[model samples]
Target chain A: MTPKMNSVGVIGLGSMGYGVATSCIAAGLETYGSDIRPEVCARLIAEGAADASTSPAAFAGRLDAVILLVVSAAQCEEALFGEDGLAPKLRPGVPVVISATIAPADSRRLGARLAGMGLPMLDAPVSGGSIKAGKGQLTVMAAGAPETFDAVAPLLDAMAEKVYRTGTQIGDGAMVKTVHQLLAGVHIAVAAEAMALAARAGIPLELMYDVVTHSAGNSWMFADRMQHVLDGDYTPRSAVDIFVKDLGLVNATGDSLSFPLPLARKAYELFAKASEQGFGKLDDSAVIMNYVGSELPGTRDN
Target chain B: MTPKMNSVGVIGLGSMGYGVATSCIAAGLETYGSDIRPEVCARLIAEGAADASTSPAAFAGRLDAVILLVVSAAQCEEALFGEDGLAPKLRPGVPVVISATIAPADSRRLGARLAGMGLPMLDAPVSGGSIKAGKGQLTVMAAGAPETFDAVAPLLDAMAEKVYRTGTQIGDGAMVKTVHQLLAGVHIAVAAEAMALAARAGIPLELMYDVVTHSAGNSWMFADRMQHVLDGDYTPRSAVDIFVKDLGLVNATGDSLSFPLPLARKAYELFAKASEQGFGKLDDSAVIMNYVGSELPGTRDN
Candidate 1:
């Protein structure tokens, strides 16, 4: 049977959301975009989005599916259940895909609230960063009822290179994504830690990077993010504040389960420290600054 | 010019050492094997080693190169400079390759002592573990004098698939290797932490493993060691104590430089905790037990 998700409304015209909207349009779907930012909304409309209204409620009843690519569970909640919420206005049984990385409990609570309004919800979180999102090559970890998945198959196909079905339970995708953030954050922090130690010991940052990328010390984060450290660039490709939030969610999840996550806690603190030190708007690789002080390579007046 | 390293000796016959010995033999070197364990030495003798004496001093004067694959800097020192040491007996100017994971200070100290004895030294530490060691495919990070590396080129070629010339200073290789250990040890511990978090969240371990291996969360250690966690097989491919020691060296290196390594310190503590919990001899992935306690998957009796 053909998927019912023909027209899609993506809330939050941020990097990830705008990419999803454009990708959906590129895939021949009737895609609408909504954001508080008028300029970004106009950009999406220029990129072939059917509408770029700042509120999903403008066409909530006409959309076949809604995807929340907002920053947090709070924004997601505001978009779906607030005074001008789209959930009540949506067509009955239309799927709402929550693509933000949030606590599993928040995802489940959102899904439950959507269900009460005769809406199906998918807890779908995307990875591979904004660059991948723009290429329609994000990796999505999603969970929901089989029917919910079937309903949004077309939108998922349009936005992701790979979609992992975590389980039928709505929160399983968030659970997996939270655990994933634990690794991703810790890997990025430790990659910075390793490079910082190498720099202090007088090894050339470029040589250490080459050795590490070739050695068992290699990680996806180390290979991808350390380049920023080497280039002395901290332009917020994925800002330090993002990990501060993501890793905080990780530790919060562990706390909710009464499970201790030491590494995740440590990584969270490092990211938080980076953010507090005014590098929050810089690339997450700027977490290296937490260890390197002002002696970070490629920044010297050589 | 023909390389002077024709005959070679390997001290320490544990898994890594035995593999190094065999790889040398496989490459047509006249290899001598030494170990505290007689049976391992006998096995190397059967595997075509020219001699399998329990002491390198037996053939020290005749050997052109010696590789110490011992466990620690202390052991390396004892094997080279102890009462029955091999250093003074070795021919003048022969290259001594120290492959142990040690503090850069210890590596430098050893190189200095060897230099005083009219011997050139290469601070070369290896990675890729025993299985790769057996196949002559290990990666070696090395530093030394130009002549020292040239002298040991043939022996290095025999034992390693890749030999990174880190720099000319003796401890540079050890420093690079120590920084590498920070990443390797932390990645393994964090992999365990991530998997343990997934297990506690009721996500299937195998599925989490698959998702992580394919995602940006992937690390060489996570991809390699998480398998042991999935199979519930704590069969000591690389024991927990290895990290306890390696990460300990990582922190000590940081200490020597007055550089703080927070993640490495945390990872070292986790591995140490695993060791104290009697999982010391189990696979390094058993660091998961520090998080999972008795609820570890595959080990729960249905």
Candidate 2:
């Protein structure tokens, strides 16, 4: 008989992880949340998540599944294998659902390491922003052995609207997710580039956004990100640094395969430039600032 | 009093022009069609356009409006002022609607030249594609004097679903259209780049298409064009050379403004390369072949 995923431990209560934890709690799971920030932990508990201890090991063998939603693969590695990490405390064969966007090679290596220690690793990297995570509508591009998926099926159902079982190989989910980021990163870069050109060319930025969202040039990222640019609101829902890291992973993968990815590489450089200009912590759409710095285009009004 | 657009001449019956001509006829206007190609002219007549002579002078004085849907600014100028052109034959204040994608500077120059001939030039470049043109649902980014727009109102209504009267400046329509092309060209190029990356990364091409169309990575061009790439069909709905010219116009405008558009320029180079590889006449999505030419990425599949 398949085991039920009745209790869950969510690590890294950042924007995305907090939503995941809340959704799990809303679904009646005994959800626990932990972050390096104590306030974040307090906030999640206020939102109905079970109380979490400062040390990740507190939930150890109690978790039926662990959702790792940290910033990067390095953070994910530290959470699982670093001092006071959950690896030594969890029961053997409990599945770890990895949700960060990381390089496929790193995911494979981590999967191997975890498997060697009798843990089943589910390579699941999610798409959709935090908003979707809150609504339990995020798309999870996931892969692992059929039995491991069976073990965490209840948790997957609670957190995702569309779960693409990409392949059985633990690395395949990360592979597809990386490819998805290549497009997402490029779309945001092109959105900034195209919108700045329009603004400089004497079209109102708002008009450009309205026309484009209705035209063939429209993209999900363009529609979503450019709205933030149009609103002049750079409150970081997804920061520029996120693309910095994601596109960096893209470039590294292309390099490993000897593939030439000029556009994605160009997008990466733009995000890096924006990050350097001190817009790293702002919304990802603030990459537009790299093009229209210190003033909105087409006018000296600023 | 606003005069009805009783008779109109549509020059250059290409994919887009043919649609514009048929749509004009469908709107009950006496539409005359002309093309360098005899067969295209014949087809338009069969589609209910009025008969045409080899010379554009056939309906010159009879036309209340002339829709110039030719290839470029040069073609637009030639159709109006070239040998046996319609310039000398047109009466003063007859509005000529220019619907080709060209630089704003060129539009101003043409507007000035036509104004010298007593014609009220309406700088109108349309969006949506051939299908929308045929359905009379194109979006026209237009600019001219209010009186000229009033004079050409009937014709504009016949040809477009959305008519954005940008301003009274003759160059304004072309400016907005140029900006629109910047997005459209970059979107197509990036769509090819992203889809090709996914194809090479071991994701089945069709599955990648499905996941992306439903994901945040989706773009109108990606959803529309990648279908051609996936079907292995290169039947040109829109050719690569089209982007070559459009992006060249984008490059020229950016240069004139001293603005940096590295990504648009990069996309232009890829389309140019694809054209050089004998895919110029193929569909624009053939740009994907540039990446996956020698092999698909992971397995020795394709």
Estimate every model's Cα lDDT from 0 to 1: 0.90, 0.85
Q: After superposition, how far is residue A204 of candidate 1 from its true place, in Å?
A: 0.7
List ranges where model 1 is wrong by over 4 Å. A1-3, B1-3
**Predicted model with the maximum lDDT:** 1
TM-score of chain B of each: 0.97, 0.95
C-alpha displacement of B238 in model 1, angstroms? Answer: 0.7
- Candidate 2 C-alpha lDDT tens digits along B144-206: 998888887777878889888888899888988887788788778777777776666777777
DockQ of each: 0.89, 0.73
Q: In angstroms, how far off is B236's CA in candidate 1?
A: 0.4
Proportion of true inter-chain contacts also present in candidate 2: 0.69
Error of 2 at B177 (Å): 1.5
Report the C-alpha lDDT of model 2 over A121-232, residue by residue, as the tens digit: 9999999889989988899999899998899887788789999988899888988888889889988988888888877777777777777787787889999988877777
